[model samples]
Target chain A: MKNTRIRVLIAKPGLDGHDRGAKVIARALRDAGMEVIYTGLRQTPEQIVESAIQEDVNVIGLSILSGAHMYLFPKIIKLLKDKKVTDILVIAGGIIPPEDIAELKKMGIKEIFTPGTDTKEIVEFIKTNVNTI
Target chain B: MDYQEKKRIEEAKKQWENRILNKVLPQFPERKEKFVTGSNQEVNRLYDPLDLEDFDYLADLSFPGDYPYTRGVQPTMYRGKLWTMRQYAGFGDAEESNKRYKYLLKNGQTGLSIAFDLPTQIGYDSDHPMSHGEVGKVGVAIDTLQDMEILFDGIPLDKVSTSMTINAPAAILLAMYIAVAEKQGISKTELNGTIQNDILKEYVARGTYIFPPLPSMRLITDIFDYCSQELPKWNTISISGYHIREAGATAIQEIAFTLANGIAYVDAAVKKGLDLDKFAPRLSFFFNAHNDLFEEIAKFRAARRLWAKIMKERFGAKDPKSMMLRFHTQTAGCTLTAQQPDNNIVRVAIQALAAVLGGTQSLHTNSRDEALSLPSQESVRIALRTQQIIAYESGITETVDPMAGSYYLEKMTKDMEKAAMDYIIQIDKLGGAPKAIEKGFIQREIQNSAYQYQKDIEDKKRIIVGVNQFRSEEEPMKDLLKVNPEIEKRQVRKLDEVKKKRKEKEVQEKLKLLREIASSEQNIMPPILDCVRSYATLGEICDQLRAVFGEYKESIKI
Candidate 1:
């Protein structure tokens, strides 16, 4: 029997309550045959990483709308590295500047999906990167 | 042909068909059916006489400010006075927010809208352990009567209408406002403002709730009763659909869920033996102005018509003001993009235009830089100017309900009304908003809609400029507001000094009484007012209630 479940953790970092995009992405990922774990609003970087690590997810998708992406993404990257969770692909979505995208990529962010990046691309990106077994 | 060439050809043909056939083919039935936009995908569409079968125009789309108010709630609308241009602003400490408020007033803004930081919103003081780095991060942080006093330092409460975006701790915030007014020598009856005491949506969409549904509802009804008696000019509760829409609800869901929640408040008030007409006349609403131009307008019209009917027919509200649906609209912040930040100005203008066309009583256009951070002073001024240009330059506001009697608008309005009524029936089946919220029915619907919209964006079904399409590598926004961490230190020190200087005995007595009243079936507002008057810290008052009510842990479902 083929193990066909794709696990995705939709985490919100910092104090932004603007989770419409995050929630929508979570739903879309779930509908696209992925098991999505949503750590609801006001989650710290530590909390999100812990949830992602414990859930042992294939992909960690962080949504930051509070303009804390610079501080938050780096912290999450450092935590994932400290935990030696290198296999889990990390991505981010929300109001990230173009200047910071290169830095985020350097820090191991696989892809940055800003506003208007289609749900299908996200689904496809996850499918291609993460092992479905 | 090679595979790549064939694939390119097929894609080109598909795009061509989509552009041409979709735009042209209304003449022939075979062509028309193929070109019809999906009912669910469109949310609204153009209609003709065929769409309004069995319709009587005079009975339905009456003149503006008339009964049912399908056209509008006011006769002249902007012709008499333009919708109040209120900007929802607050950040840093109370003093900082106060300065911003004064600036907005000087900049020709007609009303004041306060955005409390997360700590104050969830009933925590800046110095509280749980508040940590979140103090005055998103909005202003008010810890005690001192902070409230500083927030309204120079601004007279009786002079300008204020709207505070607060929910779970709305009663406490309202009490603080009243106490501040008293200090300013303003009578309660002379005060005018709105407290967003709509907790049902807090549970369903926004996640700043402290207590569970039952106590929250009780607290809200307490304000309804208190305001009806004391503050005649005050809008005690602002039934907010703005958060619901921002939470990813469709236009129909936003209207229905908001109205259902409104009904829940009325039912609770009526059960408390309060007359509907007395409190209902002062009730106001807040809605999100999303990207869908025509659909948003129709949704607004349907909201007015449906709410009027619900008020007069269901609640037996006889007064015209009681039946009127007055709402404030904030253009969707979720639609803004950080990729090409400057493009957000255009998006905001379109959304603001929709709100005006939809007959909103007030409007707040989101600053373009808000997508990346809290707007800078320059960006905020530009956002205000966007509204100014529309009110002065755009001739769309010359007529009330400009889209009235248009076959497409009427048909879409009726369709939206029917869809909303369907959701209301579903909520009714689940025993109204509170019970439905408890069961997470509303949350689930919002989640589903949110998910579907995301999927559409991902699937390329919906085109969002500068994100998936019109990709650019250059940075657009050069400046964004960056809050220094020292603001928190200053705020904490201010809170500590206030605590040290105040009468501890009076504070303790007020808090103790507040706890007792909170635990009992009595109104929490009076005790809350006592605590505010005694200068009890926000954390102290909230801690007392927290001990009585216990904290609510959200049941996460995605």
Candidate 2:
């Protein structure tokens, strides 16, 4: 199976309401010609994983500002593993502290974009990392 | 000034633009072809009397406490007793938040602003499955009346005012607060505080909403009807644009959306047959003070004037107090940068000054390290001291509306008022705020602005001091306040104990009564207060309302 455009799912996986960054990134991704589907605020880990699998997205970008990234991010990664899904790249962005980034990446998150990241960097990251076939 | 004088100034301005400005532009090119404010509103090279040809002093800019309160709300403004220095602080468990409250009060903070955790804000108990990994993370977790009591432990409700930043489950939290106050021997009439009971913003910007619009408005009006009789001094609703702005609205959109929501609330209350004067006076506002010095200041003045006219002409309320839009301002949190966190202190100080110059009634200054985590104790101390320095040392507070008569300021204020009023008219045409929200109009507008803002920053059109322009190598932020992960286990354990020890039968009865009252035409406050008094958890009561009112699922739009 081959894909024409990079499909990405931008999901907010916690109860936090700070979606400015997520919405901005989703649009930026779309502007960069990626097919982006945004799961609106307060999506559970199961919901996000299911959506990513169903949408056949090459990447899953989880945005959280609620400091629950330590617990939520790992649960999401494990869910992906248990579901026998291996093709998706999981990335995250928000008000994540620096010390927690290493652990999150070790849990299978490819990269974590903190506050003040340029959208071009994220677009470039997705284009460079995701393979079409 | 007369028309001839204005014409003369216009001619002179054109002459200067051709002679001096054009000559300098060719020799030393301007930094940018055009300059704009944070909202992208164009800024002229200079403002003059020509900008005010249509301005009417008596009708537009009146004295403090008069109709169209564009200058200042109070006659003496900060010269009389200064604005309340409040800081929004809460994290971890109840006891921890209580300690923070006492520490802030001891350090010359005049008021308290409680930040509830996500579960508490969204009407979930600490033990609920939805609250997993979220308990006591962002704010103090309060599951029931017991937790509320401990959170406010020794602080007398009569002495200091408290503002709870909770919506959707605001009625339940207000019930808990009143119950705690009753335990402290304080009467409801003597207590003064505010609840961020503006649910429209929740649907529009903040996503903590529970029920649909009709039922949500019912709950709000129920509070209005109940409070006018019992809690006379308490501010019934803090119609907020603070979250709207932080969620990436322009300054003009912030004013327009907030007042549009305010209008919707008033219309709902009036439809419920509530008295306008009684409930309207208790209505306060909350706004965000961002980095644009003159624009933010002008926004405050314009919002005050526009709201006064709305209440007077549109709603036809006769009480002068009903028209005064007293607001609490917080320094914009989104403007803070994580790259160089210490620079946030200067940003906050400038914002706090803008709030003062713009005639804010009360203010909460964001800490230096808030962009990374919850503000550290030392960072919060510095934030509070920023307000203190502006109050005592800065001589600006010595006068009322010191920036009032400047040509640039006056024109900018008028422009803001007109632009915001145009937005209100647009919202009204689309039915109202709630309808506009349901149609995703407000959300789309904010998202566009947010995307545009990011684009500007990335393109270097907008220079965010530490973020976009200045390059800095910084170490990881230290002394950052981290909520202990053990706090979640402790909170869940306490909630479980409360559920087990409480009289389950009484809890059911009270919740049953609440459902009946919510479905009926009566005020739902008394039954909700009963549910709180009986030790029923917040989630339990909201579950009943969920059954009756149903939850609101927003129409998602990118």
Candidate 3:
């Protein structure tokens, strides 16, 4: 009861096939004693939101490297909202430009990790940022 | 003379080691007891003539343009003509990407390299929900021949060589290209370019794969056979290791896995009763130019020599061109760091230099800001200039295989080649690359390597300047090229308009015909081209094939 494993669903939402970061984060989370479900590349926002809900994941991490985060993240957030799952923590990573970071945060992505992000820092952020419903 | 020279080399090495032990080693301890190459091949502190004791000039390092082209595939190399500086450019809708392509060509880019959006790459119309937000995001969106026509609007298909970095849906894209060329009054025979038609890497490294392996290989062989007769000028497949390396393969693994995939393609074509010489001669390769200078140069040289041997010995191909391993190099995208983004320019310059020194046939230098977002036009221009400056300014291009006879380079080349061949042999034992991929062997190997590399960086074993070391506080890169948010809407509207205008009956007939031939023992190209001519969308054509081949579910555990 004291050390419940946190469940995380990681999905790549968009066209970019660069998944080294996502896989690394998945490994880091799993190594941190969390359950990580890595749905491999090219998942639609609908598929990701559905997967997150199906897996009952506490954290949904989406990696988009193709500069589609502006179009993609908000869509994912909207779908999550439509599903009435507001308590689930949604964090996004990949090549999101500095100016767009604020825009992404405004769309309800709890945290956005940029390049050179330490996985430990991400784990810490997730541990602290998970919604306490 | 050999014995005396070897003795002298050994004595000189001993003296150097003695000095290092006394002065340098005592003052500064070595970084490790043993140093390994990126491939984990153990390396000696000093390489000398003794290391190349059995190295035969003709047998090993053949003259350029000769058998086992260790020196280079081209005799003059860059001297006769500089390697085609094909900057891989595409982002947003076809119109925007077209402007970029024309700008690149006008600014001295020798050819066009089209990067299709996700849906385009994986065989989906822009209107599909699976394609939402991704249409024209990473690359140009092409749902029909209409988009292809717009993409190459004024660009002559016959004159300018184009490379499409789309796999899985390569055949569909190729069909569209041929259709577009036909509309331009260009015959298929006169067109020249490459389709990164190598789909095996899609399953192994890149995750854009759609169909299963057997069908994918069939599609690749279809292109090989079709291009031999129809598009004689076209280089059929750019068997690629660029994605493999970016996916975190070591230099040796990249070479091994890529050439392994090449071997699989060759075998597949041969099994289909296609003459190896006819198709193998057109087989080109795409490699990644990573930050390791010596390793990358060695990788290129070794890949050429090994491929030549594989063709000549394994496949028994007599045509000299069939044995040659001509490759295009793109500077490693994985090495680019968003932190201190300006530093990526230097990183790309070094990697591009390695590719040039390694004797690339064509090269694409990545933009520095690419690690952050789609490169701003300024970043793309600078990326192009990096290639130009290297060609015009770097004196290294003055000589062929400038690093050919380096004691270190020669040893590393042989070592890398040997290690790669060992992996190939292991894969061969596992029933080849496809089987190896199915067994999750190659993917697991890459994942392990990727994990090790990341751990190395995190543990301070490797220093990535901007990220792990030499830390600096800087404002994030701003004004980065962002994809027009409304691109998906525009693309979907265009897709809808095309669908609405096209004859529904004809589209259905073509799609049905495609479904039939896709499962049968016939070349799927003609039917696919028919689908293209009928203005059947990429998703429709692929949907037909998907119904037969079934989508491949990745078995990779990680």
Candidate 4:
């Protein structure tokens, strides 16, 4: 079981084309030996959740830069629940405010990485918490 | 070893050991501690000369304006003339943006750089349903020749160089500009400006792209061909690394990827049977000047040298101007923090100085309040003053490549050049930028770097002043410029009027001819000009091309 690979999905939801941060996270995860799935920019909530389900990823990381996180994150969480994929961990990052992080966490967002968060910490956190196959 | 040398080495080693044991070891009691810099690079306790062993002065790090222009592009650089200080100004209607342009020109700005709103960039009229909330939010709203007329109302076409940051609908906007100049009784050959027609980066980094890559490339090459023959003074495509850097690429990544894109454009034009020297001299670049002052400077130097080598050695360019890499620099907008908004003023000033030191031909400094909203008039003025202070008060402009001979800087420039060359080789292996982009290679690399930076910031390994440290208890928010919702309504009405007043039959005939030419191998510029002159809205022209070229859906990869 320890020899099994951990699959993760990195997605961008809504109309934001700013994917530099999202792409960076995906590459770091891939380099860290995770099988990462990246959905390109301008993804709807349904598109993200569908891709996550299809990829069968253990964790889902959503990146948003357009200040549309409030509307986008909840939809993803709800879709995961509806699709009976509650076991999949959901995390987010971007220009999210501290106050919004609390509400997102309430809606089952496990972690939030903002501007200053480092790659090593994100990898370490995912490695410790994610239940690899 | 000689007696004096041996003694000196031993004493230096002993001092270093003593400092590490007594000072450094105590500071980092935990051996697991990792040191990180603002640019997210893990820094060691020290960098020795051994770190830059392969550095050569004449071969790798040449003098300013010489072959392999690593130090600077021009022989005199800023000593002769400082970089054109052009602030990115545009918002609301064309009238408002025009006023700002006039204000900047009156305040001693050397050039004008326009920032069109989302509606204009995407080729939609202000009245379009899709453009409901976004008319004047991001930048200025330009719908037709009328709006273009207002945008450059009083600005003379002959004197001041202008740069329009538009892609996708770049052809339409350029046509509108030509029409405006025509109305001013100025010849097209007399006009000098740049159009941000680099659509490849729009796909890779910025998302303001309209057409698919193939058609976009065709449109860009057409401009290159047309501008070379018709508008001699115009810069057709500003192959941009600015948006790529803003999108989170490391400095090395930005330089390598931008050059790779530049190579692709040259190849595309060459395949179209155009001589490299004919259009290559007109090819320009736009790069982001980030907070890493030395690194940014090194990146710019490395860019010039690499571009020169590639042109002379690879593309077989004969003209020296064809090999020269002239770029416009914009201070990194992403580096500006919302935490300490006022501190952004200092950050921009430092970034602007870096651009000047790096030998940029032109530059635009990001205003302090840009992180929250469009800059207020006062903030924009301060941003302009930052460039002025650097030009007059700072003695940095007295010499060309002021830091040319520094051991650390020269080594860094060589290292960056080598790194960029290696990446260029890899991209070439992957069959150039378009292929690599299709495979999501460049996008993945940028994403990886961005993620690593974010993670470092989260773990407190990287300290951003006001974010992870230097906590301010109570900071007041600065007033940001807010666009009224009614501005969009006004734009919509204006677009409606333009549509109503324009000759409907003539517009239809021109558009039909435009679509035919777009489908064929003939240059699309002539038809585009006709459509623009006939006042066919941006969206109408773009929709015709979209119909021919089809929209691009990006392939996803993790």
Candidate 5:
């Protein structure tokens, strides 16, 4: 019944506990009339991918500030591809250096949002790119 | 001035606002409809004598080192001795961080503050599957006492005062430190240092928790008992508001929540039949210094005065040292911007100056390139030099609280105290900090404030120098410090070697004893020390406790 609205999973995909930006974006997405499921701190990439598939969410927004994006983001994307769950729009935000964004995008992360990104931009990106499966 | 003179000034100020100001307002107006502090508290255009008509100087702010300690903790303040210049630095493997420590100490740094990596902080060995990408990422990785020994290889424990920023595994790390000191042929009594053992903020903000709150508090009280008996100079717990502020708490919430947690620790220790005066003197605090110069200064002053009163009135402490709220301050990391990263140096300088003006006991100025990556050697050197410049070159340290009697500062300090106290009263009604955090009251409040802060920035209500205003195109920063992925492989391999070299029989026996002590009502510190002395890994010891005290499952609320 809620299929008309976009569903998003705001996941904290690493050991980093800096969740202020993640929570803010979650609330903003919720206020923008989307359903947001926030996976709290210390979640592994496997848990994130499983939740994305289980919830049938339209997007998986990964947030990590612990400098583990180079290792963790690829694993999550690989897991989604292995499961053939390609419809989920993958995005990330945190302390990602600019040098890593190209490889991350090539690995299937749709976009990489760094620090100081406005939440409105994230919301618009998700709404425009969400693929209804 | 008398009451009549005060009345005349008040009337003249009102007339000036209405008559002269009204005429000029038609052509030009204020930049914003209202100005607010960093915490969103409204700031008036000006503060004068009219604001402090009922202010009592003697009772409210006694002399330095006197009751209430509103002026400063020491009698002469920085005139007697400059504050300790401690830079918090750690990354990569133990060898890498050891070199950084030696580098810092050689460059006029007075103290060492250790930062542990995520795996070390969350009680996982570097080889643990969950710690694959995280080893030696955020901070240094320590798998066993061997790693700790390598961390302080040449550093003399008796000479240098160290502060370890570890919480969930604090006792294990502290025990390793003690073992390292013993190996150095130094007595435990001579070791002067502190451990960030405060765990309440973990549930609210930092989230490096392993055991649940009940068992975690017991471990904290055990450390209190052990340190008071053995290491008298070692500060047991540094009740911290630094992470809470960085997690988007307003300044008022920062002090209120931090002090509330402090009260809870005291209550737990007293409930365990410990003397308040014995541990209270060693109970230090840690706070953040943000860009709001006057507000941050007032926050520190109000925090000190409020803690003094809380000890005297609430806890009935008799020792003057027990009542003093000694604290360490770090310039706010959350305030730094990634764009035009060099501008962060000026931001750090202003924040550092505010900490000095507010009477911080020790200070850490953040590096300029931190917002982009881990600071390079050059950036950290500049950060340490920033503190040195304030201590030796700036004459502000020559006086004790030079901004003490300013009308605006006094009124703001008083108002901050009242507001923060109101928050404490609310937390008390919810049965103190742990209960408040359990019910998700504190987290929700911080989240709301955090969301509002982000909204303000996005809406252009707040102007960040290089982020939202005065924009400029810049090239990518060069020489950013990157932790080598090879460090992880090398660390895990070393951990394996240590595991093979240690006596397995003694490790099992010590871990067994630790489990027995943890399950029983006895203090767990002694057994933990035995485990560390036996070269039991951090993960091995924490896993034993996790078997007894279940891991904390965070209730997700966003």
Candidate 6:
């Protein structure tokens, strides 16, 4: 079985149907020779967590634009904790405000990427931070 | 000029090109080998009469308010009445948003366009766990008829035209609007507004859909028949290109895909045995006015002409109003930059000018602070004043189709129409908009364009004044409007109060009737009105229908 490439999952976890950034990152990650999975719009946290566990992805990236990250991100983090999927590096990107970044980081998010962040930076961050199995 | 004069000019041009230009071109080489528009339309360095030597004025460029309206729709246009100054505003709770609406009206807004939060847009009440932190975040949280009543508390139904930006549950929101009007002692016939019931675009661009495609069409056609019979003044569907453009479709794809969706909606209605002439006049459009000024203006002109031909040639409708493509234009939100907040005001002003020059029937200028969050009060006021300044001060509104005879504009308009027509033909070959969307054709085109646009920005080939090429150090922005977090808790408590107080039996009976109507072929609007009047929550009504018409799960191939 093949197991060398870093597996990353990019998903939109809210009701806002903004998939441009999510799809961009998914393409970028795939171009970087990583296995990337994209869960389309309006996915609940439960669906995201279940997909993550089934795919056994190394990293999970969320793209939230609807300003519900305070509730949604933490809920996903708690679900991962309950499921004991702590090895997965979690990151976020979107229209997140500057004030919420620290709180999101404190909730076990490895990083917060806001608008204007380059996708090359995202690919590098995953390569360095996430431990490849 | 005469043929002799033209020959001399051409000979002079050839001599200059050979002698001076050829030598100078090597020393100062052209920056790039090719130039293109946002939609990948090739652009020449210059345009002249030779570009449109075969242009037809009477056949191709008809007068305003005539058949095949390549110009503006109305005869007198802004001279008779200025385009409606509608600033789309709604945030926090209903009472808070109501205050904003009143403030906007006081500031000379001619119409009200409500923006609902994601939960309300997707047909959920405030207390649902899915709506926990999103109750009133992006837009106002609308749960029950009570919330809607509070939204238009002091606004009279007969006085102002309202547009609600809701798609999946557009039928429910329309019922709530009519129910609120009834309480205000206004008849359904007196109510004038529009519901954005275009669902095909949801599958194409956004994801605010509840039911799947077939049942969603049923909901839309039910509104078409019901509103045609009862609320005669209401616009049934606003087939929108705004979201499609925002999702990064080029101007040509925006026109083609949106019109393709319009064709599908009309086909669905006609198949249901509805008269095209009766409902086609009320089928308005919404388009995005982006940064490319002349291109956007040409796009609007092209859209009107294309739709006019579609109505007359395809649908064979006889009513003049049926053929005219009346539309609302919103300044593009994707063009705004978070780098410099105040620069957005200037961007909005330019885009608004394009829409005005393009003869949009209505316009919304987005606020400067929208890229960060909901705009502050001052920011919104400035945005409204942007529209006001264009309508009152800008002399561009005096003459209709001022850019009509310009060689550049006419050629570009024809080119955009041709390109968009090609796309419509392709989608038509694939069985229409719905089947094309199911196959991800439209979505993939938008995604590819979006990727190219982003790549251009990152590579600095396309210069965003604040974002890509020119960035500077700045202090962090302050006083940006943040929705109060406690609004969620209070909204949930209010939803609980309604669920506890409303007559449970009446709500159940109405919901059951809605279920039966949804399951069968009967129109779903009357039972929906009964449910809303009985104080059934938005979630309860949508849930009852969702059980019959299952929720839509997209095929994610990205």
The numbered model that scores best in DockQ is: 2
Docking class of 1: acceptable
lDDT (C-alpha) at residue B392 in model 3 = 92
Candidate 2 local lDDT, residue B115 = 93
Colliding residue pairs in candidate 3: none
Tens-digit lDDT string for candidate 4 (B1-558): 356765676678678789766686777685456653345545455554544555567877677778887767778887777788888888899888899899989999989999888768877777766565567766888888889999888888988899999998898999999999999989999999999999889888888777788988999999999999999999998999998888878998999999999999999999999988999999999999988787888788889999999999999999988989999999998888877778899999989988988989998988887755578899999999999999999999998888776655666677788889999999999999999999899988886676666666666666678877896874545466666667878888898899899999999999999999999999999999999899998889988998999988776654
**Model 3, B8-49: lDDT tens per residue?**
888987887787656787779878987866556677877778
> Which clashing pairs does model 1 show?
A118-B457, A118-B458, A119-B458, A120-B458
Off by over 4 Å in 5: A1-3, B14-23
Q: Is candidate 1 or candidate 6 better by DockQ?
A: 6
Error of 4 at B212 (Å): 2.0
lDDT per residue as tens, model 5, B414-446: 999999999999999999999999999999999
Q: Which stretches of candidate 2 lie over 4 Å from their true place?
A: A1-3, B14-19
**Rank by lDDT, descending?**
5, 2, 6, 3, 1, 4
Better of 1 and 5 by DockQ: 5
Q: Which candidate is the best by lDDT?
A: 5
lDDT of 1 by residue, B1-558 (tens): 356765676677578668876666554435223221211434323344545665666667788888898888888888999999999999889888999999999999999999988888988888765566667877898988888899999999889999999988888889999999999999999988899988888877777888877778788888988888889999988999989988878889999999999999999999988898999998999999888787889889999999999999998899999999999999998788776888899999999999999999999999988777788988999999999999999989887787876777777888889999999999999999988887889988887877766656656566678886788886456777776668789999998998899999999998998888888888788999999888888888888988988877777776
List candidate 4 segments past 4 Å from native.
A1-15, A21-133, B1-55
Alpha-carbon local distance difference test for all models: 0.84, 0.92, 0.89, 0.84, 0.93, 0.89
Please give the distance, in angstroms, between residue B185's alpha carbon in candidate 3 and its true position after superposition: 1.7
Measured with C-alpha atoms, the lDDT of residue B129 in candidate 2 is 82
Taking all chains together, each candidate's TM-score versus the true structure is: 0.89, 0.98, 0.96, 0.84, 0.98, 0.96
DockQ of each: 0.37, 0.82, 0.67, 0.24, 0.78, 0.66
